[model samples]
Target: MSDDDLAATLATEAGRLLLDVRREFADASVDDRKAAGDQRSHDFLMAALAAERPDDAVLSEEGADDPVRLSSRRVWIVDPLDGTREFSEPGRDDWAVHVALWQDGELVAGAVALPAQGVTLATPTVATPPAAPQHPRIVVSRTRPPDIAM
Candidate 1:
């Protein structure tokens, strides 16, 4: 499948995941959100990867802590879904969808989709690479805003 095809596929999967997690991730205790969110992310990522890059190993935030990713030719480090706070809450901007791909410890391509804003931003073509972003719009978590920036 093409990059966009993969992205679209992941997007669809993420939508279902968000719905499935709505009650499960929200009803859980506050302390469990982190773990639960991580697990949800891990599961979604694994399923997506299995369908797309089954040959490529995965090194995700919630699972697959493979240091080999630091050396693998191609590895996917996915967050599945970001902004657990917004995800658990009703209306907030912190929520987003993330799927990061790395090659030999360097980012090759990725996508960040904010379903709330109806923004599914793609990389390179969408904007400059994030590492040396010319106009940096710092990401600040809703639950914990940065002390320096708003």
Candidate 2:
């Protein structure tokens, strides 16, 4: 399939895996659950990309930073689980899975899946950004505050 299709599929599948992890570790400690979810989704996404696009480079939040990606023509940047804290919390739906394709210089494709919300936003399915809200709001991470906030 094309890069766009692959990105969306990977993000969606990874989100599903994370949801399963949450169910399987319902009684586990938050730290344990978070670790499991991160590793599981990271491994799934990495293996899928290797099998599907063996020639391209990958940069993952849970994987080693390979210098090879800097020289490659195409690179896949993924965050298997963008919000570990949110994922570990019961009933929280703000966490997401991110899969993006950086080709040449610009981003060619990308996807973000919010599993609990059952929403997957992909490049193929996205329309122009909605107009700015009359009352804009900033959402901050509960676990890691930005350096600027320090």
Candidate 3:
């Protein structure tokens, strides 16, 4: 319904990724063969929808990106698992959970759901708030990529 709602749902879903189960997938590492069909993130978000908004329909990246729901006034766009590659790595920040809502073909709200970081931040409906640069200059992504030290 709202960005806050989506954020809560995504956060809950991503939190489940830290669970222990009989899961093995090939897509993670090059050596493995099969992409494990474990539905950790999928199950969590699906469950969230069931518990939160049972009446609404959903189109998820890791589950089902339904073309039929494109025309709907309010459709939930979810990426249950964004960076399966980085997520598989022992230490990588290339993964993220995305939750967004579209109203009349426009993105009304969005949320970046980070379960590993244990924080859910909502995307502003308008332009993002300007950053208060405490340092001398703005560092581009080309200069910083999380692993490097300042």
Candidate 4:
């Protein structure tokens, strides 16, 4: 598969795995749920990347930072579970999975999957943002809003 297609596929699959982990660990403590989600999703993405693109380097949030990627021509940067806190919280849909490919000097492909919302936005097919409402609004983190947003 092409780099763009690979990124989208991996991200979407990882999101599905995270959803399964959340359901399986529904009764676990918050910390436990977060840990499970992070590890499982990371493992899935790492293995998939390794198998599909054996020569490419990978930088993942849950894995140790390998210096080898610095010299590599292509690197896959992934956050297997982007919002661990929101993921563990019941009824929250803000969590997501992120996958990106950086090659040479630029980001060539990327994808973001919102599993709870059942949405996967990917590259190559540029996403057109919905028309802004007359009354605009900014959504910021509830606990730590940026100064600009505040």
Candidate 5:
């Protein structure tokens, strides 16, 4: 599959896996849910990337920061689970899976899978978003906003 397609597919699959994990751990503690989600999703993503792109290096949030990725021409940067807190909380749809491919110092492909929302936004095949409101609102973290947002 093409890099763009691979990214989108992997991200979507990972998101599905996370949803399953969440359901299985619904009655467990918050920490347990978060840990399971992170490890399972990370493992799934790593295995899929290794099988699909054997020669490419991967840098995942849940995996070690391998120095080999720095020298590789193609690297897959992934976040198996982006919002651990929200993911562990029941009924929250803010969590997501992120997959991005960097080639020769440039981003070649990327995808964000929102499993709870049943949305997968991917590059090269993304649709134009609807027009914004007359007064656009800036959304930032409630507890800690970025410097730019400040």
Candidate 6:
């Protein structure tokens, strides 16, 4: 499979794992739930990458940063759980799983999966940017609004 395909696939799988973790730990404390989801998804993605792309290096939020990635030909940079707070909340869908490929100093491929919303946006399959609105728009999370926005 192409690098883009691999990125998309990894991201989708990671998102699914996050969803499963959330469900399995539904009654746990928010901190416990977040921790579980983060570690589980990270482990799944890292293991899959190691199996599928044994030669490539990986940089994951939940994993130790290996200096080896700097000299590697290809690196997979992943954020297993981008918005842990949102993911642990009862009814928030803003969290995402990110998988990106940096090859030869460039971001060759990437994907962001919104599992709760059942959406996966991948490079080469990414949607076209919407037309710019007449007014400028700044998007922010409802739960953690930036202090400067006030």
**Which regions of candidate 1 are displaced past 4 Å?**
23-35, 104-106, 124-150
Q: Which stretches of candidate 5 lie over 4 Å from their true place?
A: 125-150
What TM-score do all the candidates reach, one by one?
Answer: 0.65, 0.83, 0.61, 0.83, 0.83, 0.82
Between candidates 2 and 3, which one is better according to lDDT? Answer: 2
> lDDT of all the models against the reference?
0.66, 0.93, 0.60, 0.93, 0.94, 0.90
Record all residue pairs in model 6 with backbone atoms less than 3 Å apart, i.e. clashing: none
For model 4, residues 10-119, the per-residue Cα lDDT tens digits are 99999999999989999999999999999999999999999999999999999999999999999999999999999999999999999999899788899999999999
What's the lDDT for residue 105 in model 2? Answer: 93
With candidate 5 superimposed using the best TM-score fit, by how many Å does residue 101's alpha carbon deviate from the native? 0.3
In angstroms, the error of model 5 at 142 is 23
RMSD (Cα, Å) of model 3: 7.3
Clashing pairs in 3: none
TM-score of 4: 0.83
Encode model 2's per-residue lDDT on 1-150: one tens digit a residue: 988899999999999999999999999999999999999999999999999999999999999999999999999999999999999999999999999998899788999999999999998643577899998766588699777666
1 or 2, greater by TM-score: 2
Question: Superposing every Cα of model 2 onto the true structure, what RMSD results?
Answer: 8.8
**Superposed Cα deviation of residue 103, candidate 4 (Å):** 0.2
Writing each residue's lDDT as its tens digit, candidate 1 over 16-119 gives 56656665666677557656655775687788788878777776656748776666688776676677766666556467667766666666667777765666
In Å, residue 142's CA in model 6 sits off its true spot by 24
lDDT of 2: 0.93
* Cα lDDT, model 1, residue 32: 73
Q: What are the clashing pairs of model 2? A: none
